[model samples]
Target: MTHKKLILHVSLATLSGLMIFAPVATIPAQASSVKPSSAMLKKSNSYYKKHYKAIAKKYKFTYSAQTGLNKSGTIYVYEKTKSSYLKKSLSLAMNYWNSKLGRQAIKVGSKKYHTVTFSVSNAKASKSDDSDAWWIPSTKKVQIRNSLYADDLSVITNTTLYNSEKSLVKTANANLAAYKAGLSTTDPDYQSKLDTYQQQQVDYAKAAFDNQESNLKSGLAIKAREFEYANTLAHEFGHVMGLKHSPNKSDLMYWASGTNDIYNYNKVKNSSKGFSLVTSTDVARAKLAVKVHNARN
Candidate 1:
């Protein structure tokens, strides 16, 4: 599969001044045919096989290493219980404007779609934080064919999203932007570099988010206050789908909260802030309006 050359974190200099996270240290590039971790490839391929081909040829596909969408998308949330931490967080994820990023998801156009499914976690046999999520192979195929790869994670789910450090989110977002830029028609070899860059970026982001969260953070639970906690989930979801901050301070996707209450876990904003979890850009990239395949492999 071909893809864009968007190896993960290079230098923040490529992006304008918006980056809030520092650049990761460099690593040598790898050859093609370097398979992704089994978990990442297995899930990503399913997402690609499910959605990428459905995208119309008329629309130019946009993607990089960490994140991208066809013309539209479907974000799938997988969890096992109705009240598990993951489930509660996903509830806010699907709420849109009620969600910081989900609200923005509507704006990115017909490129994406987000779907949530519940799978109960079996305690004793499995730990509560054992679950992870992804876009499925159909989405992966789009990235692979475009030469895209994941640097941080294939998909961000309940604990993974929030448990991550704030700085790591900044890094992934930049890598994602670089990946997206590679797909620009302006790039001379968009397809040629897409796969390697994508793979490296995605792999890099996953490791960074995971390691940083463990290294930099100590302890903190998602604050209660169903509505506010939901918004937080929504905000994090925006990061998951590759959204950046909005200039509008009132916007849920803003870099800082306009209300000075981002910490209010249950705060529900029926005000303009309430909307979907995935941002418009997130949807635009997913190529969601296309058809759906059977369950994930």
Candidate 2:
């Protein structure tokens, strides 16, 4: 055999091995440095330190009708008397989780925040109406109503708001005192429990996906388009809450879903919808109805 032929054969074998076992890249070491914003940092530090003041409170993730608005927190879904679309969506999701979806994890805010979804009647059904921007204050963090909305916007780790959460949040923390007392990160039981917990989350997501078809076919698709904020909802609830869009192209939050799907926009019907959070560019052209209760004088 020629030396050149032998070299080609070796290359093919190496390529085959790589195809069989693709290597995983290490998660970036400076992952924390991907700071959302500098203003967010300064505002968050001052807000948390001042209001929470040495709060060792821990949050837990659980399936409860009490999602987002916990016993200690507040989240209200309201519709103004005038906007029909806003009324419909709020009415649609009012008690949506009384069944299976209720079994899924939900975002929970701290006790301080009076979490609310004030659906304005004159405001139309637009989720981007200027009114809703209060939920996600732009660069200005101090103006945020509570620390939960401003600082503790659920990002990386999903925590539950249960009684046993104090230790749950600290479970990931490598406390020297616990290590010195004999607790080890390598304990089989600890590893096993963590694996089961993570697997449960994946399983729950799979179940959620299974219902996606039905959800899309039903009132949700109409609501999703009429409101024109499915992307915002998915981005806010899923990504901000630590879930990524599946590799599948069908999900609305797909990284590449931006080019405007041929199916969604073509058939989306227009309704009596207004905006709660308008894009910065839109704020100049259209006047949105901000809720009377929440209006800034």
Candidate 3:
């Protein structure tokens, strides 16, 4: 998810110059791995509070550290959409963060911590053309374009294709077995027939493997797009939790949307290998944000 800088010539003061906050410093990999001392954590919290408050004051926006999380440290989100599809996507996004952090960092509903609201609509022409979702800090709203919804048709198609492939594999194996069992070793051409059948089977097996591999890759791609949508929602939620864009493009907090990082499961950089939705740096920053908020209140 990327924030679109919108300039409005309206009388509504709060929405006049709506923009996202500036990028924060990227956490080093080693720093994220080592637990910080209380002194260091306090220093970091002071810096974050000063930085965020400065930005909000300069921009005439409200900055409330007391809003997004409860004292129990869970972020409760509410979705304001009637569509079950969008609701499920938000649920998946929240689950992604909670799993990565290994705790109940985000819950689906509770007005006590409803500092974040998720909603969906068609892409507005006023917003940037490339953005799939945007988050407004002052309003505590995350808006996702309806186009980002997963394709139900693709899922059905993949399932049908899988069943067809399974049936074909079973039939092929049975036919090959039947052909081999019916062969008569007493015939003069028995050896030639056996050799030919063996060769045909080898060829068929290789062809089938290749086809299945191709189909598997295609199916994985569809799944990846679905994951990307959920990842985008999670990315927006990251903003609500006080995370800024990362300099590392592989990170979930990166500024751009639709980089297709989920497709590369191998976690290789500069390749088709997939990476995790949230890096350790993102988790560390989110946890730190929670601590800062808790300390502030």
Give one digit per residue, the lDDT tens place, for model 1 in 258-297.
Answer: 2323222123222324323343433443322122221212
lDDT of 3 by residue, 175-237 (tens): 777887898878899879877886776678568656644654565444444455566788877
Whose lDDT is greatest here?
3
Local distance difference test values of all predictions, in order: 0.34, 0.27, 0.56
Please report, as a residue range, the 10-residue window in candidate 3 with the lowest summed lDDT.
Answer: 4-13
Residue-level lDDT tens digits of model 2 in 1-297: 000000012212231111111012111122121212333223443353453312211111111112223232223333223545434533332322212123322332233443433322222213222221122212111111122212211210111112113333344333433443464677768766566665655565456444543444554444443343323332223222222222333332232222122123223323334123312211111111011111211
Candidate 3 stretches greater than 4 Å from native = 1-39, 42-67, 71-73, 82-85, 110-113, 125-129, 148-222, 257-275
Sorting all predicted structures by lDDT, with the top scorer first, yields: 3, 1, 2
The candidate 1 region of ten consecutive residues with least summed lDDT is: 141-150
Off by over 4 Å in 1: 1-71, 80-86, 97-224, 258-297
Q: Give the CA lDDT, 0 to 100, for residue 295 in model 2.
A: 20
Assess candidate 1 and give its TM-score to the true structure: 0.28
- TM-score for candidate 2, residues paired by index: 0.24
Quote the RMSD, in angstroms, for model 1: 22.2
What lDDT score goes with residue 181 in model 2?
49
Instruction: Give the per-residue Cα lDDT of candidate 3 at 130.
Output: 36
Write the candidate numbers in order of decreasing TM-score.
3, 1, 2
